[model samples]
Target: MGDIFAEGVGIAGRSRTALAAFALGMSLVSSAMSFAVDDTPGIGAEMAVSSVAGYFLFWQVMATEGLLDGSRSRGAGFMAYAAVSLITSVAGLLGLVLLILPGLILMARWSLAGALVVARGSAVFAALGESWRLTRGFTWPIVGFFAAVCMAFAVLLLPLGIYAAVSDETANIGAAHYIVEFISNVASYGLSALISCGIVAIFALLVDRDERMASVFA
Candidate 1:
């Protein structure tokens, strides 16, 4: 059996390397969208949209950085990466429509494709293959990590959510609600960025461990 806790510990130890980059990227996207949505009724939603964009961007940067390891990528083949994601998403969606279990399994197995692309600079299909290979016997762990992330977020946000719900009809509701929402938003984004870093760290750790195991058995 794999030492799941050890994998988590290793990821936590390396989170600092990727956290700042993820946060900065997300912040920039959020701020830029904030300006665009100024005085808009749906500003919060707009900001959320931008933050999501930033999140994806941050992961790309993390993958690029992880693969190169402090070196610069002339170009990590962005078109290829995007194409890979689109293709996989479509297939995953179809699988989901056909069967929930298979779809989820496919999603988890292909989760590392982008990172593999960064690491190997290979074609999208090749990267997918690499991710699938590296994740063998580790799919459950990968799903568990995501579940852990979700649980962490849910635990943290439950109180705020309850407060918001309870206060919805009280006087000064707008002000208090905004306060709670602001805190909730910040907490959510911060947690999300942390999880993204953990993902990069895990990808790095997994590939490294697999390589070490291969060399040992060879």
Candidate 2:
């Protein structure tokens, strides 16, 4: 926590500007992809665009994790993570849809998959398997940690939420309102980055703990 707060989480301080730009670009590209496929038929452009967008999101997550772990590799790393995103996402989503508890458990168990894949060049399935193994008996703890993080984030975002709430369904909104909304958006982005950093920190901490436990067993 101290290191992440002081030095710059998974995204190293020096390159955050580049990261923000990259995130912006990926979002725009994803939006364009959706627009391009808006009217496509069954199993068409929408699905393809969704897959691409999912890839970029996964790529960013793993890339940040890798950066925090001091991995110098790029491009190919992102592509690899993107490919693995499909499998992890389906597994997680299925768990969530069929039974919420199962979904939450699966998500918690698989949360470190991105970090594992990024840090080790492991296959997607291998990474997911490792996460499941490492997280054993820790699922509830993981969920509680994220819930606390979200609560803290919500506190920071309260003002924005209030403003948005008050302005809801109003026509002829003004420049001041737009400025408020912009501020809100920037705050949201900062919080999001912090959460990502938190995830990296959690992965590192837990992995270290796992190692120590294994040593005791040995």
Candidate 3:
């Protein structure tokens, strides 16, 4: 597990450019969603549809530009995106059972698997099988890694929370609420972007490790 984490960290450090691009794209998407929600409180359904569409489009770009060695075939990119989306959707549905524990695990595992499939030009089913096989003996370790990462993220948020609280307490006059809200929103956005980027790095690491192991055994 320590080795896995170390490898992941090293890969992430080396692939900083790709990870930064991905993270920036994610931040833009999230900011757009926030704006949409703020502008139209009752447009949740529209927002959901828009978000899904945007997610797929962005993911297609990521597949072509970042993952597939610069391949930009539209058909292949869309197919890869759809295949991954379908797998994750099915996993989400299945997660409903066992109170969704298994489903969440599958979702996280398949994220890496999807990247591998697209980047390596593997079939969807084959990728799923490989992911399951590779993750077989490391389930608990992966889970623990994710949990620790999430906890670390939460701890990072504490300072932001405190800043918001302090801003709120010190605010005065008519602009107090707006100022506090703006500050809090900005802090939240920044923190969310950082955490999201970390998760993407983690995904990249998992994909790379799985591929290396697969090659070694093959």
Candidate 4:
């Protein structure tokens, strides 16, 4: 787990440029959408946009390891990833609404679906099934990782959260608000990149282990 997380950090570092572009573009869109919706209905829009952004980011991360090296098409991989991720996110969100533990467990189990889609060109259900199989024994560890990641994200986002709250209370919607929000969005996306890369690392580790075990048995 430690090694996988470290590798993910390294991947994020190496792909910082693409990450920056993604962050900037998405943040601008998010801010604009928030302004349009006055921040209420925008919540759902934000979630939808974020889901799509995550799929693109995951694909970019996997591309660093040669996602396009074979005959697999990018369009197909992306569509598969998008479908599976949407399903996972909806299920996880529903679980969270009912009981948070189920949501976390569901997320941990389906975390690798994105990687499987890009790496093996898996279909939506196939990738989800394979991810569940691969993550069976590692669910708790992944949940721990998720906890650590959420803490880090919260810490990084503290400035923006504080500023937003203060702005709301003081009615200070000025130029500085935009500046802070943009910076905060960048930081959030940076963390998202790290999390996506971490998922890729976990996928690679599990696939490698499976291959080694198969060889041993054969």
- The local distance difference test score of each candidate is 0.63, 0.59, 0.53, 0.80
Local accuracy of candidate 4 as per-residue lDDT tens digits, 93-152: 898799988988999999988788877788889989989999998998888777788789
TM-score of each: 0.63, 0.59, 0.54, 0.84
- In model 3, which regions exceed 4 Å deviation? 24-29, 32-75, 89-100, 108-111, 153-218
What does candidate 3's lDDT look like per residue over 1-218, in tens digits? Answer: 46556655554555455445444554455445654666465356444553354344434433533545455343454465457667676765677465646755775565455555545656777777766665666676665655565576567556656665676577732455444444444444444334333334444556655657889999
- The model with the greatest TM-score is 4
User: Which portions of model 1 show Cα errors greater than 4 Å?
Assistant: 1-21, 24-75, 79-104, 158-173, 212-218
* Deviating ranges (above 4 Å) for candidate 2: 1-72, 83-103, 158-162, 165-168, 208-218
Ranking by lDDT: 4, 1, 2, 3
* Model 3 lDDT, full chain set: 0.53
Tell me which residue pairs clash in candidate 2: 95-103
Query: After TM-score superposition, what is the CA distance of residue 155 in candidate 3 from its true location, in Å?
Result: 4.3
Per-residue C-alpha lDDT of model 2 across residues 1-218, encoded as one tens digit per residue:
35434433534353466446544544454345534645355236535554454344434554645433455354445555665666666876797689756766776788777666666666777888888888887778776655565577678778766875677557635666565655665565555555555556557667756766889999
Residue 21's lDDT in candidate 1: 52
For model 4, give the 10-residue run with minimal summed lDDT.
Answer: 65-74
Give the clash count for model 3: 1
